[model samples]
Target: MGKPTGFMEYERSVSHAEKPKERIKHFNEFHQPLSMEERKCQGARCMECGVPFCQSGIIIGGMASGCPINNLIPEWNDSIYRGNMKQALSRLMKTNNFPEFTGRVCPAPCEAACTCSLNGDAVAIKENELTIIEHAYEEGYFKPNPPKVRTGKKIAIIGSGPAGLSAADQLNKRGHSVTVYERSDRLGGLLMYGIPNMKLEKQIIKRRINIMKEEGITFVTKADIGGNYNAEEIMKSYDSVILACGASNPRDIKVPGREAKGIHFAVDYLKATTKDILDRNKTLTPDFKNFTITAKGKKVLVIGGGDTGNDCVGTAIRQGAISVVQLEMMPKLPDQRADNNPWPEWPKVAKTDYGQEEAISLYGEDPRVYQTTVREFIADEQGNVCKAKIVRLESKFNEESKRFMMEEIAGSEYEIEVDMVLIAAGFLGAQSYVADAFGVELDVRTNVKTDAGNYQTNVDNVFVAGDMHRGQSLVVWAIREGREAAKAVDTHIMGYSNL
Candidate 1:
């Protein structure tokens, strides 16, 4: 702790963001970074408790409470407070491979679980972290550090997403020849495509990829293992294979008129939009086509109340959508923490995400409709989605199944005209083509079957991580799994791992 009374002396300070109306004109990051002096004050607020629940990463009441990767929160905060940004970044990188990505996108459970939050506001842990790493970059601290000796073993990673990138970083540091194969035309699977440039700029991802390349890690893009290249050839060539392909298969609505032309998956729509932006900016330099899905002057309807759904809402508003409405089957959560929710636990409260805030600023009302779902889609004469038939639902806990189920109420049906529908319900599991091509066994949920403690699959020389193994999850969890799987793969190759 830099100052024992820091929490008492200084109030919590957070970074300011651009006004919603101004930011809706274009797709760019709007969150302002805190100044160095302000960052120090924020870091000093870390109580650095004896227990330090910020790094505990426990699942209190079955919800995540702290940093999932067990980040050294107090140590880094002190380092920042003491004006030792180099030391602060070193501490931050000890656990997380990509602090820059997490700094911008993570929900910051550490702040929610902070000891100071009981009465006062929590320390600005997320901002402090972002400041440390950005300072490191500005001071020329980040550079390529290649391994001294090579293990002479080759490993194939079957995805270039967060999990695969984390695994590649660790395994390469352990002196193994690691090659990441991506089916997309460019690297950084979701990082390059699924996410908007405004949230995580593609240049940041490219900078890290360039550094990894300089450190002898190879990335081969547009290499589809199950389709273009033979999976058998990969198995015979590499000593071990890590399947880090994320869960890309989107969940679909089975209602009538689902086959309408204007209906699309949230991932597909986001990918296309980002790709167009990248192409127009000449970042990727691909021949641009006139494939347009713009929401300009069109009524937008987003189905599901998750992050992806919110992303769709934000993207539509930015594209100049005339109006937007998001539907959630479950009832709205309480505005504040409920009786069942306690301190140091993730609060289940109604909070405005970035997208909703943008929508409300533009439309003069909150766009979310709680306790509602689309029963069917209405198509125009051209077989394009023009409206949605929605119904309010009542949720109850099923005693036998121990799950919350929703049932549509009688005489609660309504209709809303719309030009586009984005489905963001959730993902079921990873696509089965690659898994089936390798003849790998799958669990009941269709995720790759792996033995506990050993992330290896039933198929010989094949390992799995990320959503392919554990189902859809946070980026932090995927990075952890990737690092652990790399250690396992290194052990399998050299008969032992120093990773």
Candidate 2:
């Protein structure tokens, strides 16, 4: 512990964000970092408990309670408080392959599981993490350090998302020749395209990719291993193969008029906008007319109450949507935690995110309508969606089935004007083509099947990790999966893993 009474001496302070209305004007990061002194004080607030649950990374009540990467939280907190950034950055990077990415986007389970949060506010772990990594970069501590000697073993990582990058990072550091293949035009699968730029700037992903390249990791873009190139060719060439392709097959809402022209999946909509941004910035004559999926002058309805739905709301607002409303089937959470939800468990409570905040600023009310769902999309004569048929829902326990069920309230159906609808419900699993090509078995949920609690697949010399193995999850979890998969692969190839 840096200071025994530091928790009492200082209060938790998070990074400041710009007003939602102002931030929605441009697709860029809106959070302003605190000064170095302020950030250090925030770090000093860490109590460094005897049993630090902040770094436990355990699952409580079916949700991740702490840092999944098991970051050395207390050690780094003390390091920051003592002005020892060298040690702080070292500790931060020890577990997480991408602190910068998590710092900006992760929900920070570490804070939820913080000891201080059991009573008062938690340590500003996420902001503090961002500060440490950014400080290290400014001080030139992130320079490339290629492996001293290369292992004869060659490895090919399919999919250049967080998992693939992390796996490649670990394997390369262990002296293996690593090459990552991405089907997309750029690397950082979801980080580059799925997530909007305002939440996480694309430059951050590119910066890290460049450093990895300099450090001897090879990256090949627009190379679809199972499609453009034969999967067998890669298996024959590399000593080992790891699949980190994320869960990208989105779940569809099968309400009436689902096949309407104006409806789209959230991933496709988000990707198009990012690609458009990249095209406009780099090209003299931007050819993004086909890439544009705009909500300009349109009344938009996004279905879902999760982070991706919120992102869709923000993107629509930025794109000049005339009005926006989001639909959530479940009822709104209480303002405070329920009795059953104790400390260290993820708090199930209502919180207005950036997108909703922006919507309220512009429209004078929260855009989320809870306990309701779309019954159907009313399409216009031109085959474009023009309205939505919504119905209110109530939950009741079914005594016969021992399950909670959504019951539509009688005479509660209503119609609202809408021009476009984006489905942000969530992903189902990885796409089928790649998994089929690799001949990998899939669990019932369509995720790549690995041995229980292991990353190795049924096929020899084949491994799977990240969303491909674990289903849709946080970026931190994906990074952890990648690191773990790399260790498994390393052991398989060298008969020992020093990763």
TM-scores for all candidates: the values are 0.97, 0.97
User: What is the overall TM-score of model 2 with all chains considered together?
Assistant: 0.97
lDDT, candidate 2, 364-465, per-residue tens:
989999999999998899999998999999999989999999889999999999999999999999789999888899999999998788998888788998
Q: Which stretches of candidate 2 lie over 4 Å from their true place?
A: 282-291, 399-401
lDDT of each: 0.88, 0.91
Model 1 clash tally? 0
Best by lDDT: 2
Error of 1 at 49 (Å): 0.4
Q: Which lDDT tens digits does candidate 1 get at residues 348-430?
A: 88888999999988899999999999899989999989989999999888898999899889999999999999998988887
